[model samples]
Target: MSSKAYRVALSASGAALGAIAAYWALLAARQGHILFDTRKLPVVALSGDFSTYSHTVPGGMVRGYVYHPHGEAALQDLFVYFAGRGEDVRATAKALHWLPEGFGFAAVNYRGMADSEGHPSEIASVADAVQLANHLRKAFPHARLHVVGRSLGSGVAIQLVAQQKFSSLQLITPYDSMLEVAKKRFPLVPLSLLLRHQFNSLAHCIGVAAKTQVLLAERDDVVLPERSAKLIAAWPTPVSVRTIAGSDHHSIIGFEETWLLLVDFALTAVLAMPEAV
Candidate 1:
């Protein structure tokens, strides 16, 4: 080959390689922003029956809220919540009245989100969930524990349920895997290779015995209907799937029907279990 022709070809190849490297590096460096979107959130004031709870995690302290309907000693059914991306979980305090009189609720900010400290990642989030579950189990030994996860939280919920048995699980607008979602958006980029916190909820569905309920939004463009359907298909046991009409990813969880379904599902799961001696 001619020297000039070879030099031009080499330059073209070098440019392509440089562009690809920059793309990979950009994604790698900005992963925390893309995944967690950690930011300073408003401080949630403790009031009524709500109280602040803190736990020592890997990097730092994780703070959250706990609602004791009948005080700590009289805890009934406990609903542990994992919130969607950038969702202020303190908002859960407002929905306490929707639950039964005896029900309790608890939610923690993901590491680096809201009041929580430390960096947020899939591994750290799941580890924090395990710690939270153990703490709650010891605190409310008699209360049947149920889980509610929305959007990104669904991945955490699925992984938690797989490791530690929960009475029931309610997943709102969940996706099978974050990796899959990324692939759809960036078909050319090798997300599987670049991504670190790929929350693969579908893979963890094996052996999960929890009674599951999935709420889907009819017009969900974020997680998309197909991704949710894939997760539903992979569930070990039969899943109760409900698609709310005239709703998108964020709004579906706000619907009155959605709350009713969550409450009813929690109650039904507990009722289905044989009486605890």
Candidate 2:
């Protein structure tokens, strides 16, 4: 080949490689932003008595609320929630009123989300969960603790359940891992190389001992149904699975059946627990 032609080809190849490298870097950097919703959620006027709670993490505070049913002197159980990305946990805490008397609900904003400080990542969020769980356990040592997680938060919940002891766990529209979910959406993006937050619930499933229930949205396009199945398949114990008809990823929680299912499963878990010595 002529020297001039060879030089031109070499320069073009270098440019192409550089562009690809830049593209990969951009994807890697965006993984954090994509996995976490750090924006402020719309303020909804909450009803009932909700106590504000906060936990000090490495960088900043994790702010949240705990709501107990009115007229209830003794709490029977507590529901600790890990909300989906961008979900307003205040609204979720309000909905806890659906639980019968003696039931309490608690939830915290992930770091870098809402009023919570620091950045959101798999490791940091999981660590925050551990702190929150310890706090909740210490505060209400007598009450049975149950966990509820939605979408992105499901990963955090799964990891927490793996390390902590919970009476029950409910996961709504969860995935095996963020890496798998991203690959399903962007098949050509090379998420294995570019994605930073791999919330690999499947890997943690072996450690979970809680009575688990998994709810799936029939039309969930965001978290492909198969991804959830992979986590369910990995569970050390049997997991009860249900599909809410006529719902997608975001809409599944809106159904009355969903809440009923969650509450029923929680109660069932409590009933099945051996009486405390």
lDDT of each: 0.85, 0.83
Kindly give the stretch of ten consecutive residues in candidate 2 with the minimal lDDT sum.
68-77
> What TM-score would candidate 2 get against the native?
0.89
Residue 15 of model 2, lDDT score: 100
Candidate 2 global CA lDDT score: 0.83
TM-score of each candidate? 0.89, 0.89
lDDT of 2 at 109: 84
Task: Give the clashing pairs for model 1.
Answer: none
Q: For each predicted model, how many residue pairs clash, with residues at least 3 apart or on different chains?
A: 0, 0
> Candidate 2, clashing residue pairs?
none
